[model samples]
Target: MPDQTTNAEKLDRDAVADRLTDLTEELRAGENVTVSVGNKDMVLTPPETVGYKIDVIKKQSRFRGNHETVRIEIDWKPR
Candidate 1:
């Protein structure tokens, strides 16, 4: 079976930026990155290069109004 950990929450722009900044720093440091997902801690070791993807979605609804979502994904195989 495949193991996966996922976490999602509404965070302010600065908080989100801080999280991203930390992740970027860890990746640049060329070491395993420790991340918290929900209540669990996950350690990831990304290779020198990895797959990157970005997606943008816009939605409109009469009752829900309109919103845009930007999704970014980075993945790599562990050695």
Candidate 2:
């Protein structure tokens, strides 16, 4: 199957914290995770064992100063 992507973003500190907390709890509980962006929603159940990756990029610009973005991804397939 081809990969599909949906992007959701928030700059508010509280909003970002809430989203991160929700994701952490779902992963820790081993529950099916459901996420909604605008009118589209997706439910995913990761396998018992999965591969995880994290990437953080830092950038600097004369106009914008410095900033960084972190991306976390998980992958799994049932046997």
Candidate 3:
């Protein structure tokens, strides 16, 4: 039989690294103004102007045979 695993399943490290890189770029560019995780929300204060913000949310694991998933949401406003 041949291997049926996907790159996503075999290497999840890149996904996180990619996210961090994207966030860093956004912050550095001042394109992201706010970030929200779960019920908590943080706004970028003055001198920290962000025109856009991306939010990544992951649900808590529940039950066996369940697969982990991620949801990404972006919030932006005109400067």
Q: Estimate each model's TM-score.
A: 0.89, 0.72, 0.33
Model 2 — TM-score against the truth? Answer: 0.72
Off by over 4 Å in 1: none
Among these predicted structures, which one has the highest TM-score?
A: 1
The weakest ten consecutive residues by lDDT in model 3 span 2-11
| lDDT on C-alpha atoms for all candidate structures | 0.90, 0.78, 0.50
lDDT for 41 (candidate 2) = 71
Task: Put down candidate 2 lDDT per residue, 1-79, tens digits, no spaces.
Answer: 9646577665699988887788778778877877655477777788778898999999999999999988888777733
Alpha-carbon runs more than 4 Å astray in model 3: 1-12, 31-64
Clashing pairs in 1: none
- Model 3 lDDT per residue over 13-51, tens place: 886787567566756775434444435555543344334
Superposed Cα deviation of residue 18, candidate 2 (Å) = 0.8
- Candidate 2: what lDDT? 0.78
lDDT of 2 at 21: 88
